[model samples]
Target: MSPPSGATTTFLLIEHRREIADLNERIRNRRLQVLSLYGTPIVVVLTLLVWAGLKIFIWLSSDTPTAINAIFFSVAVLLAVAAGAQFYAEFTATVWKDAETPVRELRLELSLADERHILEARRHTPPPTDRQASYKERLPQELVRLRIESRHYRRMHLMMQWLLFVSSAAISAVTAWYDPPQPAKGVLIGLGFTITVITAAAGYFKPRERAFNLQQTADSIEQHATALELGISPYNASEEKQNLELFATTVEGMRAEQRMREQQLDQPQQGQQQVI
Candidate 1:
């Protein structure tokens, strides 16, 4: 049978591809934003809990002035209120709905396309011309997901690092500011313990390092894919099949390295549990 006209089929395919890409990007960004929003509240709430707990503990144990203790207590309460408000605002945000609308519309458009047009569109789309293209075609969705996760992990790692630094500094300042019997001393001790746990957790999880490794692997895969697509040096072989097999093997090796890194990160926790 005669194929569909080139102009119409090509146009449809290109438009669909572009729209899908746009929608996917929007969805990914929105999800990351949501993750960030939730992360802030978690940190804020945890800090408030620690602050309030230590404040109460010190107020009960020490002979600190009532007025000063009341002021600190009020500050903690205010902070709790502020954190709750922020969480409420974030929870009410509508980015998810906004992102989903376009995705649904795109899906509907695809479903409504005539079957022959669909086939024609697929045929009109360019084939994978190199190892890079093949890799992309094989794992387009996975690559996008990994990229998003890596970015999210990087942000989380940065936040944890900052919190660790600030908490440590606050502990030192608190210790230097007052005598041993002050209720605030309890607050400092609590913060110090929290900071210690955060430091240990950060070291054990190594989110920053994991994110870096994942990003590096993704970039390496992309670089090879691009080289293959361009038929550039090291991928400028006449035998396309051989080049593709080699590319796949290299990508698999990178993935294996990623798994090994994850296992190494998990070893500390495993050892602690075994000892317990």
Candidate 2:
């Protein structure tokens, strides 16, 4: 039987395939960078801040008063703050970037392609439009909007980073103006310790929270994908495989999250039952 002539199904398939291919390639190539740039520097800056704070605390807590104590203390505090700010900014940018829209939408496109391929494979009468669509496709238009939202969030993250950087730097500068590691290293040692604790706390929490969010989002996506597949023909081999892959990825993540949550719930419950 002849296929739909004016429907442009082939073109749709080709276009979507190319797009998914491009996105997958680009995403794969840049995955390392995205992971690295999004949050790694925060760790380094945090470490420095911690060490600096510890040094500052030791200096301030000591009874052996060095004449340069004030100056050293101030310098350590300022530098630690600056490091923290820079790390926070970078992390903010990273989270938004990781959470952006391409991840979901590209998979949806693959699903559309698969639907087309499936119709072709059925070897039945080809109609004007391919009616066999998987439930996996949530909505292309909505997905596009989500991608936009993701980028917008990324911009916000960038702004946050800058805010952190400038604010921390400014604080550091203020401390520096008051005192520097001028005449004696002992002056800054105690101040370093104090600054480290504070800076480390801020830096770690800022990005760690974002990581937690990503893990949470990943779990949500997994649930949606599973629900989608449950309503569809999973054995439809003629369809694109990418959607399956995406679903599989999310499913694994969800399973892990479920296990963790279950463990948390049972831990407390088990303790109570034991007491009873």
Candidate 3:
């Protein structure tokens, strides 16, 4: 039996690949959401808030006799919150499983296409419509992807910085108006703890640095791509293929450098840990 046409096979490959990627991304995001919901820092903050709120309520009501009951009540509320978090995590896991099923099906479908046939079809296929897609065809896609990631990191950095500022100001204000044995003290403690967490997160993650590195890499790739298109500088080659090859090489090098930067950012203390 003869193999299918090159165009049909290519279309099938591209369509199924895209769907699988999307499904995997969805599953990954759901897992991250569940993990964040029950993260240690989040749990600690919630616990502190509950304790503070309960203590304040007891003090305000002047029900000194029921202070023991308030303690038990706070315990009950924390238990209930834990149960809710467990249920949400389970629900998220179920959603992730559902998303994964489609991905498995898609992979199985692709596996049914004979590898030899797919490769042969691709070989006979004409070049893609995009002229710059001659080699390292994914460079443009990766550039756009990096730009999106850069923007996401930038937004996170901005939000975290604002959180730090607002939380610090709140703590200072509460301290200035401090009165011992008052409910405001509880509020001040909660604010102080939150600010400490935020500061630690900002220092550890360094989102601003990540955003800057990503944006710089994206910009460099874009500059090279634009130069290649316009036949300028080092990209001004007599042969278009040479220019494209150069563009692909330079873009790939930039991407590799960006990946290295990310690894360094993620594991800055790795060497210290190893030494210890």
Candidate 4:
């Protein structure tokens, strides 16, 4: 029998989809920005390179020549590096767009729990049309599984990170080798190297950090959902508070497995846990 009306069940949830109407609030996949950034520098570098090559060709035919090729090499390397870095930033932002799914899944779990609580509180609503009640009952478990799946976003995140890396390495090597910056142009060459190094490092590591964070968050949320699906609500306790322990593990650290242990201790091992 249902509890006498208004006994709400709340499940923490993450929504898997983003549907915010405001464009500003929307998350963009990091890929688009990265393409632009990478592509732009490539374009700029190529133009300068071609022009420089033309100048070199012209110099060869002339009776006398100036140090035009040196200037061209100096400028081209700097521009290519700048573009690569810019693209890297954009690529990571694109990765962040994928973060929305984990957030969304968490939201969904919470929303489902809220529905469960509401249903418990209600007294005499007609049975949900057809299998709707059964469907609702199954939702909690499904939600947990869905959330667990979201944890892999980090894997995808890393893939994109590597993509940027390989591309950057190839580009940088080619730029350096194809047109070695001359020592007489030491100042310019040094500046170009410095910028390229800095940008490459940032682009490579920043998104990996974010991917880690997102995975951690997803794991925590999924664990919480699992406990709730089995009828263990941390909302009430002699269970004793642990200072948002779940959040700490999944959000800031790799504690999904630890969370599972904590939640299991909160629940029972003797009986088969209910699913659906």
lDDT of 4 at 145: 52
* Model 4 lDDT tens row, 1-276: 755432322211121122221222332333344456557777776878687577677655764244655666667777777766664544545544433244355455546655654554353343433234334355456446534544454565566556556655655665676556464255456545655665655554444444444445555556664664454666234332232333233333434543453344344345216410
Off by over 4 Å in 2: 1-137, 177-276
Candidate-wise lDDT, in order = 0.70, 0.52, 0.70, 0.48
Give the alpha carbon lDDT tens digit for every residue of 1-276 in model 2: 766753565665556677657666656644544454455556556756665675678755655355455655555666556555544544555533433444456556557666765665454444422332332353334344434544554555565566556655655665676665354344344445545654654453343334344445544654465555564544344544544555555545655664554344334456636644
Candidate no. 4 TM-score:
0.25
Each prediction's RMSD over C-alphas, in Å, is: 10.6, 19.5, 9.1, 17.3
Which candidate, 2 or 4, would have the higher TM-score against the true structure? 4
Best-performing candidate as measured by lDDT: 1
lDDT of 1 by residue, 191-260 (tens): 8888889888888788898788878878877888788789886778888776776777777888898777
Q: What ranges in model 3 sit over 4 Å off?
A: 1-9, 15-132, 135-138, 270-276
TM-score for each model: 0.49, 0.23, 0.60, 0.25
lDDT of 3 by residue, 4-83 (tens): 68667677767656655665565566566456545744665676676667669766566544766677566667766765
